[model samples]
Target: MANVIDTLFSASISRHVICVFLFISLVYTQNTVVFQPPFVTATGPTVTAFLLGNTSDVSLSLRTVSPSNTTGSIGSPSCTDEATRWVLTKEQIGKTAVRIKLRLNQSLHFCGENETSTNCCTKLLCVLEALQVTACVGNTPKASLLVQATINARLFPASAGNDNKTVIPNQVYQPLGPCPCDLTVRVCDIRCCCDKDCASEDLKLFASHCLPGPFGGQVSPDPDYQCSVQTSKNSPDWFPFLCVTSPPENNPYLGLFYHGSTITPKSGPSFQRQIVSAPLPVNMYVQGSPIITLNNQYFSIPQRVLGRCVNGAPVAFLENFQVECVTLLRSCPTGSPLQTLPADLSLKVMSGQGGNVVVHVTDKVVTDLNSFISKNNALSSAAQKLLCENVTLALDYKFFWQGNGITAVTLTRTIGTLISNVSVSLTTRYSAVFLNGNITAEPNSGNPGYQVGKPVIAGTMDNESESIQRAFISIWNPVGDGLCSTAEKKVVLFGKNSTSGCLLPVGQQTPPQCNLLRETVTNLQASLITSTYVAKRGNPDLLNLTDWMNISFVTLNSSTAMEDTASTCSGIPSHQHILVWSLVTGLVEGVPQREIRDLQIRYTLSTWAQDCGGGNSLCEDIQLFPITSSVTFIDIPVITEPPKARFQINFTEYDCNRNDVCWPELAFPITRYYTGEPYSQSLAKGMILVFCFITASILGTPWRQIRQVWHSIAL
Candidate 1:
């Protein structure tokens, strides 16, 4: 293969069939043939450029490429308008001898001026259809190629190849295992529920979109998207479980599967499509109306984001056209075709917070160039933002599952997949459930991306049953890898063998010796997962999830440390103090399952006796906080006020009974009221000294007589 190569459909002279038996020779459709066409491999910093040319009175078409030595797919008429690229197959790696049968299949004749005409030079020569190549960095030991391409931009010539082999000129290329990563703009790592941490019972996640698209599939607009929300999963029946799954490779986009139950993809509901005026923003990844969530489960009307050029700058603009939003969430029996929206419970639509976003949409997807020019007048700078021409398709699908016991759950998100924006998260109604544990994710060798499912009791396991032992969940990556870093190809784990207790350095403590541990990813994917930096959109440092996470846990009277006292949090601060510690717990919520004994302290708020104002106040003193707050953990605000003061009886000094009145009437103080501030005995002593001085000078003796007596005594 030569370097600096370009496809030349030249028309300078006569044509001859040059069948050079160099690497391969094969016949495609009887009408097309492929000579060992010259190809340029990458040389140093420069890569091979396929140049599709146009000449006078001649047109060439590349019919097909039948590889004799390797297996791959080659687009037809690849040498048209612009240079085309090739996507190599995984099977082609490591073979030294490679050849292909290049053929020219179809050509439509075009009218040109006569040979003697003056405008003959303007005759079109060749067209390079959207096809190109990918550059491969040959790795001797591993069959995977480090591929790079330029499909999103124009400054470079292109080629195609799968994880197989192919290269594009001028595109940023870095290998994560065998995958080629590209991020022209930026990715949205939207923080949904977990802030700094999601251990508090008050956590929420929300999403909204107009021109939403389906995951692993194309974008469309039709049926509108909507959702029904239950702010309280306290009933447990409201905690929805999801079974996110995929069929065979024939249907990569169909992941009607998840943690709660097992269902066939065909059994899933079909999406409804319609024509509407106000479409959602384009480029939706997940689509669900009335998103339902619980432990290890989540549902959302996901959509993708499409971008366009504005005044020469590329800006993400939702498809300008209307869309058919899929009804992904199932509606109650009270629903009909016109009433598919969630009927039972609706979210309060908390604007600008907790998963809710305010998006400004415009009609930008104009697939029709003529319509774009005609509709968008000279004033509309968005004319350049043509995303789609016609109406967008609605992603209408419903989710359903029947099970028992509060099922421990899992939501598997594919890491190290093609698209980075595909995300997954879980949320419950305000105060519905408290979460604390660890998150586990890793690649599934039998599958593509890593798994995001939780192991919970389902079917006969009623999700609310005590059988569900609260364990590891939504915590930070146990390995301490960054969000996107561990996300590429890794599995997060949580619970019983909770790492929260382990303090030893990694690899230092033997497995079983630490009680809790983490699993290992395969060699190839591990290479990328072990990196300290989060390589997203080529910016490895894009996100740092070190302190910020949505996974945590809480427990009452919880203890993993041996020396820990039962009164660790239940005892009063001091005998003189009025407060009694009733209990202590670990943060129990989503996936933060660490149990450090040293870090354990008196978790005073959760554990306490009846509200005895201060240390001795009666039960009636305890009450809810009188003030209301706008800030909240989902539906509930900070609350449950303790008594203003407490009291206690003291009889250590003397008789505690006189007339049988055991209270304050007794000789010794029976009951002592305790206000937070203390009275000062030192202040009383200072006051007495000042009073004595006043008495001596003004009341004890006349000023002149006292002075004479004092002088005589001194003489």
Candidate 2:
């Protein structure tokens, strides 16, 4: 029994030793465990609290005067002690509440005992205590005071669904009642409004102030008050007070300084007051008187005679008049009162030769008279005698007397015979005369005194002339008369024999011979004279002889007889030789001298005669004569160049008086610019090249690129 007991004791001892070794090993390799109180309570007039250990196993301790006293409740002191206590544990981590009731003027402290007083002395104070329960695995432990409370209560570890028994969480606290307070005052820059008592109540905030010259003269704060200084007269400066004045009214007659004053004109006469003289009359012609008249048998006088004052006397003047015979005769009758009287006439008075006096007259019958008379008188006297003896006499006398002045005695002729089956003709020629003078004559009358028809013979007979015998033969027996009786004695024998039984001695001739001789004597008159008788039984007067009619018998017989024979000849005998002679004179007056100047006058004469050239023949001839006259008045001198002195002008020295010589010149400024080469060649060529290049690039490169891309995409 003693041995078994010894064995048991030995085994117990061994176990105890093992146990101690294991305890040492565990202590060497594992974390140490510190023992702390499970619960802590605090109650004191002033209290402080502390937490120890890590979050994994936290320790709570109370610092109070009587923390071990149980009789003191957590926040109040009991009758036996001045302190109270409570516990902090794992379950209380989030479910715990801390309350601190601080008295006025009392102080409480946290973390260490009485290290510093809390601000709760002026109010309630509270705090949250956190205990970090971290694992003892190579790390330091952290504990915190997370939440605090005063009259306001707070909880720690907050209310949450999941928790690690570690860190203390944040909490929210609310005041149980009105929180205790302390008051403070501060100053701020603002405007305040005043109350009725003038005390400020509301505030007005102001914008921030900007300093001057802040932007280095680039920007300005106030632009309205800016000013600039002017440098010269042309500067762009504004002055508000100045303005231009209005111009005064203009008047040319008044001086510039004499406004509103009456101006006196320089002395001169008005046009109405000037004196003017009348023009004097000019005398062109001197005055004189001259006589004028119109003869009764020739011209008709004007009914109202016009007169002009010449030498202080009114003188009757004649102008244009007409001359016509009362009887329808071409020539005035023999012994007619106006046959030798003046016809149309006019005259005027003149102080000098240059004065004008004109007379106009018409001589209707006088035209071609001189030419006719000249031709008729040219016929042989022997031809006249033959006609008288061969044929019974028949006389036709018609005459017109026309002249500007008195008509002088002119010749007349009577036709005593006409031969049957024979023709006689005469022709006249004309000449031109131009004269300048006035015509005067008597007034016209209806009856010019003369007998109508009667005849008387003049001049002595001559029996020896051969012309007389021819005249007798032609007058009584143009175609051969009855034969002479044998009892008749021939006073003149006209045969080729000198003596024959046909002749009878003188005085031995019987009554038949005397009768034959008387007949021969009657026919042998030298001049066959005719006269005008006023009545059937009135004594006849021979027509006044004029020098225009004188002619030799032989000459007359040779020319006249041949002419007569030739005129009456027929067939081949009509071509017998003939002779003619003529004399003529013409008078004219009152032709203007100027009209005759440089004048060409032409005269035309014509004749027609009948002849037998076996069957029938007519002869006609014309002659033209021209005369020219040039007149120049010696009274008026010729002037080749006229005077130009009236139009000549003279210039004086004062004509060009002027003070200023220069005047403003009109000018304009012209600006010139250089022109490039023609645009059509230079600019258009460059543009065309550029356009072609662009078009080619677009057409060729882009198209190729597009085609390549398209093909690749298709592949």
Per-residue CA lDDT of candidate 1, range 1-715, in tens? Answer: 1111123322111111112211221222222222223342221122222111111122233222332234333322233323233322211212222222122222323334454433222324422332232222221111111112111112222433343231323111111212111111121111112122221221222222211122212222222111122334432442444322332222322222222222344333235423323323222212122222322112233332122111111111111121222222121112222122232122122111122211111221212222112121232343233221122212222111101001122221111111111121111011011112211211111111111132211011123221211121111222332222222222222112221111112222111221221111112122321222111111111123221112221232345332322212232111100111111111111111121111111111122223435543233422221110010111112346864543324433343443333344321222332222333543455467778998787865598788889999999
* Global Cα lDDT for candidate 2: 0.23
Please give the distance, in angstroms, between residue 426's alpha carbon in candidate 1 and its true position after superposition: 24
Candidate 2 per-residue lDDT, tens place, 1-715, comes to: 3233223222211112112212333432443432121122222332222222222343333223321245432233112212222222232222121222221233343223454534433222443221212222233322222111222222334355543222222111111111101000011111111111111211111111111121111122332222222234644445322322222211121111211223454555445443423322212211111222222011122122122111112221111122221222222234322222223123221211122222322222221122222212233444332121211111111111111111111112211222222223312111111111111211111011111121111122233221111111001111112222222222211111122111112221111233343333323221121111111011111222210122222211222322212223111110111111211111111111110011111111111123324443332222111111111111223356876564333432222233232121111011111124453555566678789999999889779999999999999
lDDT of 1 at 668: 22
Give the number of colliding residue pairs in candidate 2. Answer: 50
**Weakest ten-residue segment in model 2 by summed lDDT:** 176-185
What lDDT score goes with residue 148 in model 2? 17
lDDT of 2 at 161: 52
lDDT of 2 at 658: 35
Candidate 2: list runs displaced more than 4 Å: 1-322, 325-510, 513-524, 529-715
- The TM-score that candidate 1 achieves is 0.17
